[model samples]
Target: MDAGILFWKAFCENGESELIDLTTIEASMTDSVVATLPVINPSTYTKTISSPVVVIKSEYRRYHHALKASNEAMPINLLYGWGLIGYWGGVMFLGTLWKVGQWFYYLRFNKSKAKDIEKPNQSSQGELALPKSLAMLRHWILLYIVIPATIGTYHQRLFWWSNIPNRLDSLIVFGFWALSIILGFAGYDTFSGNPTVTSLPEQNWEMLSDRTAILSYACLCWLWMFSGRNNIFLWATGFSFQSFNIFHRHIARICTIYAIVHSIGYTVEWIVYYPKYFKSLKENWFIFGIVATIALSIMLGFSSVFLRQRSYEVFLVIHIVLALVVIVALFIHTSYFGTQYNGYLWPTVAIWCFDRFLRLVRLVYCNFSVFSGKAKTTNASVMYSSASDVIRIDLQPTASSLKGRPGQFYYLYQPYTLRGWENHPFTLGAFTNGFEDSSPNTPEIVKKKVTTTTTAQLSDSSDDAVKLKSYRSSSLSNTLTFWIRPYDGWTKRLRNECIKGGGVCYPKILIEGPYGHTQMLHTYDSITMIMGGTGIACAVPYVQDFLGKSKIAISYTSKIKLVWTVRQPEFVEEVCANDLSAAICDQRIEFEFYCSKKNVPTNISTSVHSSDEVTKQIIIQSGRAPVASLIAESGTEAKLSNSRAAVLVCGPAAMADEARAAVHQALKNGCRTLDYFEEAYGW
Candidate 1:
């Protein structure tokens, strides 16, 4: 029967298992041998040696779990597991606290003034939708929470040693730190009392196990909250999953290092220095741990930024496969070790499963709808703007209603775009429910349209209201629009398809999300949007949403400014003509257009269009934007008039850096409370 026993018999008879030291390891029938040995690495079977004595298990009943088994401090180690529970709760607590303050600030500053509201339009709509800003939390968090925690976590370690070369060095140092925490492990030494015998070194295995329990718990946030749509992270931070990805990678690095160190400590103690170590090496628990660690290491390597950027498809494929393997291997590993660690592992599994379920539900809801007694996927009409190198797609929603806010991006999937599950994220450009809300589908030289509604009807008539609502609902397209700039892979493929036809292609597409932004722009008393080239996709939705509310004199966003820098004027040439007219007509808004190659438009400062006492015009200029002057202008206006101001920049890295510097300078000069936000694509 027992394989271990058979191995022992075989070894005694023919020396088949030569790896194990059979001479030193006596299969004793006696009580025990109280051997005096050096205390090196301690496990559960171990205790604090009075002087220098190793308690080696001589009696054996169960084959696998028989080696040096001890139930010492089981209750104590279980208590340590609760430390991980505290860590998860702590992060969630902070998120809730910060979100509370953001709500307060947004409600206080941005609201309709009542003076700007036109009497005719005010009664038609039920209420103006002005979502509050959650963006303000970052400013306070960056200074107080992030800065202090970062300093406390790593700064002290800097002074511990010097001459750190790079990030790799930091990872190695952290690994070493993980190893050094196991005290009383100062290399193997000979036992003078029992000169002939050698035993496994004693270490603080209890401490090692306790620390890693907390670490694995910390990692669950990255696995669940960072990627999941319905996570506490989204509610607390009010930012897209894109914004939280970086923090996920950082925490993952720490978690992996702890896991590797955990495996190493066990291997060194039981398999390396212990007498007759080969017997213990044949155990299943030790081998499962090794497999789990290797799988974790492979997953981390493939998920690195380099691999992800070079080829996302390959990274995603291998990443999921390796993650699955790690999960299965850990199930075996922990189940064998005992379920004390399942407090972390089981919850991680549950979170991952729930997230996948939500994703599947979202896909079906977005793509499937009943049309004429049959379920079908919605077809999207794609139109290419040759002048701007941007493709605008108008998607008819399957659902009766479509809703999204600024800064949210959707994962777009086209059947013919590429092969094997290819999806790209693009910002929500602009959308409309009815013709009144519908932006004019204009192409070439932004045009203007002026209409004076002189329909004089009683403001308090329910019949007219019902008629108006019914009429608008019948004509509602519920269109979801997105502007995608042509690039490599999917974009280039779509470009070729468009060029082959008459600048348009109607492809069946699937939509996955209506994600959220960090904060509502209405929170700021004054707001400036700096956009470079195609980065306007991120800003356009906010502009359109605010413009609608601004026309009816909605909420607190009174002073709005947009700074657009293009390589050539033709970049915006094919844009709707009405968009230009509407933007220029709004007195509450100002525009600064900079064209690098095109000369200044003749109407820069000479003439202005006036309709019904509203006068506005575009400020045309040559070359790049004057960042210093623009920022100085913002600061002066905020100090003189507004109590608070915000700058939102979505552009190339260089442009964003410039905007950030200017915003920083304004704050340093003691201007009104100014906050800066940028939308970057580094992920």
Candidate 2:
């Protein structure tokens, strides 16, 4: 018989009964006749064992276990941990560096305190907290938003969030490319490994694990910086939350990519080492990680601008709940698994808590007084107009020192009526010192009475004069005005209430912040304010500001124009009766009111601002706004003045887009340099 048949005969007697060493069998079978003979036919072989046969998984487990303990894996993990720290520290240090740069700009104002800053009462503080000229100052500050995003989008293009305009910069782009190249080589250790040691396979797993942690750490840092009150602090340091918002999607996308990679890496590892993936899933740690990934995916999916615009309150609530769920899932996942990333998650949680605490502190400070109660606190008084469908809220404040300027906004919390627990942001339409409405019909009579009363009471005492002056200043400090056009949710509910209650109701309300730093307006030679309907609120305060100050106070601001488009004639009358009336006496302000709707009302006031420039102050135009023509006129005025024109607009998206187009046209039409300011009340 042949050696092959002899070996086949022996295997049939011993099959599945005992482990046969392949090397020993091969060495014995290699004796001449087996090498010379054809391979044995499968019809000739049969199993002799009574038990079922199974694949032994011991080798796969030993492979991964040995690789983990290998010399190469140890050094790879050490280097990974060190590199992760460097990546995290680098981001934090860059953020700090920009903040420090802004602080240095602030320090430059010490010697000669800017006389032409905020108001006389507000101790001037812009320095570089706000841009002097927008483009030069903003781009440098925008670097913090650009770099991390470049790393993700450079390799792969993600739509809308990926390769969008204004989010990338040259300096940050170069830094990102160079850093990525260095990190890529060092992280993989030049792919050096022995095949027998399984270093290559194990190092692949370790690299993926390390990158997941690094990306996660970075995402948390961004979250801590960009969320609510934390974002406010960063804004104060000259890095606005608006800029940080651009990077939010990019960071989130990158982290998601890392998480997917991590999940796949572990899936492969478990299948190779632990035999059954379902068994690994039984561990709470593995399940939690999977849940976190799912939660993140859902949160990111719902975070589009369209969904937010559709229903911000719902989107906000869901976004927040999902974020909390993700954090909790990640916490449980890392803790039970003994993953080192648990420490990073705590800082994120702490920052979120701090943000909530700070918001609470703001609520208390803005709305209530410790000494008194709700009676002394700033309560919102709602005044609505049925014809215009607008709500004029006059907030009576407790803190007189907390006076805001022309361009700022505050959050309104109206729980009893809005049908939501959150606060809504509104632009500061007008700022009243509280004394304006209460001022006596005649200024001369009021002045005479104050002078007479003080003289008679204290015999012309200097102390009484000083007291009177302080009283006059403090009287005007605490009233804030907001003009809201009812839309949906809170505004719609309020509008219905106003409709039922004869267009006015005073509801108990709480105020939160005066958070904005709307740089300089007085520095410009001419200003053209384009107001779409209720956008008059933003323009009116600036007019009042210009009128109150003299040539000595505002040397640059010679000409001011307000182009207002209102749907109803009643809207113009209501605003003019309140805020616009004050600017009528000032010749520098040339305001026009345009009634856009058909069958224009007879009650529209043709109020003349001056005896000289009677036509300039408040000109009435019918139909839609001639935005392009008005811009061209303003550009001509700026050219005549030999100074840059500032076109400040506050309105609907259509109006804003029109203004932006007109601005481009103005720049083209001999306007030396045009600075555009858009006041959008976006929450």
TM of each candidate vs. truth: 0.70, 0.69
What lDDT does each candidate get?
Answer: 0.56, 0.59
How far in Å is the alpha carbon of 537 misplaced in model 1? 1.4
lDDT of 1 by residue, 1-683 (tens): 24544445543553333434434344432235433344343334455454424324322232223211222233433443344434445555755676776776554433333443454223211233223343345444333332221222232122232221123224433543443333212222222222112232343442354445445544654555565655656767554354355445555666677677666666555555455446755877657767878887887788865667678778878977877777777777777658866766777778788877876677677778876599877668776656456676777767655565578777788765346277777777666656546233222222222122311211222232222122222336666677677777787788778777667777778887766664567545678888887777776677677766654555456677888887644344333222333455566677787766543342222123333334443444668778667877887777666356778887765576667667656755656356667776434
lDDT of 2: 0.59
Candidate 2, superposed: residue stretches over 4 Å from native: 1-187, 190-193, 196-206, 237-240, 272-276, 337-339, 372-375, 417-420, 434-477, 551-555, 598-605, 608-617, 632-640, 661-673, 681-683
lDDT of 1 at 451: 23
Worst 10 residues of 1 by lDDT: 450-459
Candidate 1, residue 330: lDDT: 73
